[model samples]
Target chain A: MSNGAVILQNISKSYKTVKALTEINVSIAKGELFGFIGPDGAGKTTLFRILTTLLNPDSGTATVEGFDTVKNYKSIRNIAGYMPGRFSLYQDLTVEENLSFFASIYNTTIEENYHLIADIYKHIEPFKHRKAGKLSGGMKQKLALSCALIHKPEVLFLDEPTTGVDAVSRMEFWEMLKKLRSQGITILVSTPYMDEAALCDRVALMQNGHVMTIDTPNAIINAFPVKIYAVRSNRMFHLLNDLQSIPETEAVYRFGDVVHYLSHSKTFDPLSITRHLDSLSHTEITVNQSVPTIEDSFMLYMRKSDKFNISQHDN
Target chain B: MTTERPKVIEVKHLVKKFGNFVANDNLTFDVKQGEIFGFLGANGAGKTTAIKILCGLQSPTSGEIKVAGFDVYRQTNLIKRNIGYMSQKFSLYEDLSVSQNFEFYGGIYGLSRKQIKERTSYFLEKLELTNEANKILKEIPLGWKQKLAFSVAILHHPKIVFLDEPTGGVDPVTRRQFWEMIYEAANEGITIFVTTHYMDEAEYCERVSIMVDGRIEALDTPAMLKQQYGASSMNEVFLRLARAQSAEQ
Candidate 1:
């Protein structure tokens, strides 16, 4: 446990009748880039709050860099840098002023840790004189990241830094994170984007206040229980209904241009799918064995979890 | 011979300037009736400015534009009446009940009480939320709220519906379901003008236009764009265009 830079032991939190997190357990090692991959209301924010010492969990304990979140909150706060989901900086203050203010609160000067944020800061350097509110969305994100690193904390927690950002900017933000990781900082980030899960060293797929699976992105995809076929035809719109009608079909969902069809049996043949679509008067029908992505795994896990919840209700 | 569909959205030499900043510059495009047209761009790329103009929420400095066959400048009210809009930031009233939110939006669109009651029940049943109709809006899950918001947006049965990042943070299953709803609406001849950051959703559109630094850099079908850019997916096409703009600066 001492080797873990951040550790949570059976953490559980609830808001009135709603269970935000239930029996969550995770351990993030030092200098490792970890991701909490889930959608809204998946308890990502609540888990982050518990780790950052902002909220007390109803059960269990968490530690950041060997400091207990509850008993040693003062020390934990000093070594933990957190960027909330929303932009929480002062709107009236200029970008430069905001950075300096954050540094001052930690009893440190921006110059003392200038190298820590030098890469990200350069992107927003030209807009230092502008008010924080006047900056664009991408620029605001860069500035927020720079402020979080200005104090050079031992661990960083970023909550959905690229939630609404464009594809190009998101790519750039992940690059920044990799650079930070190379400098030996333990980083824990959360995102609703499944594609981003692949970029992390390891990810915990969460849903409904539970951790469905935890592993590297490749392992998670390889562990998918059933085979998935990418099916497409001339009539793309009708493909969903036609595929679902097939007796072997277990689940069907659209992925970009093709409809990803899962079978109830693991030994399902791609030829059968093509034959089914061909009989429906569909032309240019293509059925290919596709690789399961993190998204595919996430959806499968979510379905299993839903069935489990339903069975639990029955009992 | 098949008849050609009429153009529902037309923009020629559009321009909007705020002081020295040119938010939209010389944009021109046409959308056919019942087409799912995607408007995509990076942050601060002027997508919002152009959408505001089309939605009749803001006046363009100089543009010859028509939405739903109404002039953008002179017939703003008429255009507003013919279109529905929903954004991620503002969609429904969380303080009200699920049915109440529908009633309020329906009333604002000038529907009769009887029409509101009938449509509310109809949609609630379709969403399988008939039992939860009296639940508070804040109590429902985010995915349900989003689906409800979309249903409410089109309750007036407008000629066009504008969606701005409608599936931002929903689970993958619900996100796909939301797109199914969109497909159903489009099948009924309701024009869809949507903006999203998800490249997969961009591929779902009949045609997509990507903006970079206040200009439409590329506009074509997903397959055509991929071939033109020598990319395998829409995500590559977007990164190529947006990254080139930043590199130039």
Candidate 2:
């Protein structure tokens, strides 16, 4: 983690008895477009809060830009921009007002760093006078990014920045991130969108308060240890249920209009599965093998890691 | 979905102003009957403001707008009864049970008791939420809540249903299922007026209009928009457009 702008070692946080983070270890490289990919309550927000110095980790040590997360909270906050998962911008303030307010809080003015946020700021400048609450999803996102970049932070933590934003704005926001990263700002974004996992230079896969894997998106997808298939038919509901009940099925779940399943019995035949279901009055049966995605990898790891955790506990 | 579909929603020279700032500027568009029309824009581009005007929630500074054969300013109540709306927040009472929320929304829409009962069961069965009807709204998962909200919005059989970022934080699997439900709704001849930030979701719309600086920068089918912007995905088109728009300023 010597090259890292943010580092965490065995950081754990819990709310009462419910553990939100469990001994997490990770390092985010400087000027890297890193992503935290996980589901809700997977402790992504918790981990981010600790790194951004918004919330203290219950245990272990963390650092941002070589500054201890606890000992140098102000120093870290000064250099790191954080866009929370929720819509945290001042709703009453107009777009420009929110930007100026955030810049003021960080002891800067929009003009001082206008070049840093110009790409995003220009989009919201016309609405600079429009109340934040009245702005649309995409507008709010641009304004948030503008505020986050006003101080010219060395690192940026975008907690699902694309969430609640329109498809077009979501895309544009990532591009802005790329441009900012080119300026040597380390960016760490978290998103529940699997397709977006491809946008990051690297990602940490999280589930159930634990880190499953962290690597390049391509490498993670390549490491998927099973043959993935998208089994589909006209009777999607029936096909999903029957696929789940198959004896050879290791894991069967509905993904979109298709049933995505991994085979425990490697010799399991799609024809037989389709035939067996077709015989049971399934309609328009169609089954074909498909490539594995990050979502599939996450599910596979979730299952294997659940067993691994139990085994480790037994020891 | 409508073979002989008339323009259900028409907006010509639509302009909405909040104080002196122009939110929507000389907007023009038409939503055909049964078409899934996507209102797309970067944040603060005024998609929601335009939507609010069309939905009769906010008054437009000036424009010729007709929804469901009624003028937006002169006959808003008639338009309200003929259309359904789902906000980004997804209007649902957390304390109310799932079924109770359905009843509440349905009653608010003026559905008779018999209609509410029949529609509730049908919707619950369709979404597989019948098993969780007794559960409180907050207890149900976000994905289920989204599905239930879509269900309740259409329970009265509105001619058009407006969905604002309906699948914001749900997982891919759930979001995909949610789109399937949208497809089913569109198949039922329901015009879907949706706003989304996801390129994949935007691709599902029959046509999408990209707004920047209170104007329609681009408006066409997803494929056409992508081709015009010389990008691989709708997301890329958005990035190029936003950057270009900002560079001009």
Candidate 3:
């Protein structure tokens, strides 16, 4: 109750025996761009639904903008905005109608908050008369965001906002998010794209209903404990398999065309590995040390959690 | 890879007009056999319209079109039989179980019931969805659902498979897994024509065509497209082409 924009304290939720969220504790500062990143079934949307007052956590307490989710749901709803993962807008309504409808529902007029959504609205202005169903994926995304911001909410929750959008649309959308963040809007966006984690001020990597790590993107990447190398050769598929079987190799998985591997050595010599691979007839070899990315850090974290689970099972 | 004369698909002066709006304006391209071709565009960029025509779903307003060694207009049924389609929404039934989804979709693709069962079991086992056979589709997580939908799309082992944003809403890992499945299909000599908003996914395709405002703005391999757009990534290539197209207009 310290006037934090969003607060989730030891929240727990389950559907029958399947635990969706477990002891989730997070506090988002006012006007911070926070990201919840993980694969599907990672409980990101669950946490979002809880904090936004759409669904109640079975235990513990959560608040948004100084209002309790359960006790002050009405107030929380009034101040917060949410764009669900699915396209939930009225398909029969025109783009303009959709915008106005959402604005009116929030007790505001589109005209009153035109400036807030003008940048996005301008793209879809000519298609204002078109039905929401007819809009393109990118335009639909813009319209959804504009509708979410029409009432000028202090906190916005976007669940995988760029999931199906084109790469260009994704870039544009993130740029829009950054602009909104500059205007003092607290954004909590959940995405499965690890690259997008860099765009946020800070991110919480979630998995299996738990927050694995929370830090700035750079901090997260910097915090990766292992030495990483990008390894590619003519025989990449077989090379990855071999690297996984190596004693020194911690993780070996395909990263784009090249296979990225982590060695359990701070002083892992690049040429020695190259020569070793060369002896195995892996030609056109390009083995170089590269900085750990968000994916690397995420993998490292997942591996640790998996090891812990395995040990616990044995015990 | 073949320098031979017989192209798998050849489109010349293709035009598809929906009322007054021209969906495809004099588009032309050649798709080689066993090529993982990408039909890429912004939403409303006419990529879907062109693909629909090629798949013999919609008759072009006026064009010379040939697919799978047949005319598009007259041999539409044959074309449909020869090709498979995974729409952006896909073709999975929400009420069906994982195995039922395969049976239904595979049956529609004209596979024998026995073949459907075998393919279903093999794919389910391959995808590690053996335990989820009885689970309803809507009950499964999105990543699993997406993969299953794709598996059903290629269930019949058609000569070609048209995928419309197959990895939408899926996690990165799922998307990667989906692409590997696509690559596996391609490796088996199935011509893949996929449309995706994810440029990273485009890199998996052997060749891609970028459509903007009812016309192809660029067509090349991912590396070539990136180099032509003078960008480091396929995402930037899309941005540059889209921007260039808008600026030209």
Number of the top candidate by DockQ?
1
What RMSD, rounded to one decimal, does every model reach?
Answer: 2.2, 6.4, 3.6
Q: Model 2 over residues A185-212: C-alpha lDDT tens digits?
A: 9999998777788899999987657888
lDDT of 3 by residue, B1-249 (tens): 356634678899999998999999999999876789988887678887888899998999998999988899899999988887886475688988898888888878788988998999999898877988999987876767777877887788877888988876554555666777887888787888989876667776778899999999899988788888788777788888887765674
Docking class of 2: incorrect
Question: What local distance difference test score does each model get?
Answer: 0.91, 0.81, 0.82
**Ordering by lDDT:** 1, 3, 2
Q: CAPRI band of model 1?
A: medium
Comparison by lDDT, 1 against 3, better one: 1
DockQ leaderboard ranking: 1, 3, 2
Poorest 10 consecutive residues by lDDT, candidate 3 chain B? B168-177
- Superposed Cα deviation of residue A16, candidate 1 (Å): 1.1
- lDDT by residue (tens digit), candidate 1, A64-174: 988999999999889989999999899999999999999999999989999999999988998899999999888899999988888899999999999999999999999
lDDT of 3 by residue, A1-315 (tens): 476788888999998977889888888899899999987778988988888888898999998888899999999888888999999999999999999999999889989999999988999999999999988788899999998899999999999898866666687899999999999999999988888899999999887778888899999988888778888887754786666666577667666556777778777776766877887888899988888888777766766775212111110
Could you tell me how far off, in angstroms, the CA of residue B244 lies in candidate 1 after the best superposition? 0.6
Fraction of native contacts, model 2: 0.39
Off by over 4 Å in 2: A1-5, A9-23, A39-42, A57-81, A86-155, A165-186, A193-196, A207-210, A225-315, B11-30, B60-64, B212-232, B236-244
For model 2, name the residue pairs that clash: A96-A128, A138-B43, A139-B43, A139-B44, A166-B196, A166-B197, A167-B196, A167-B197, A167-B198
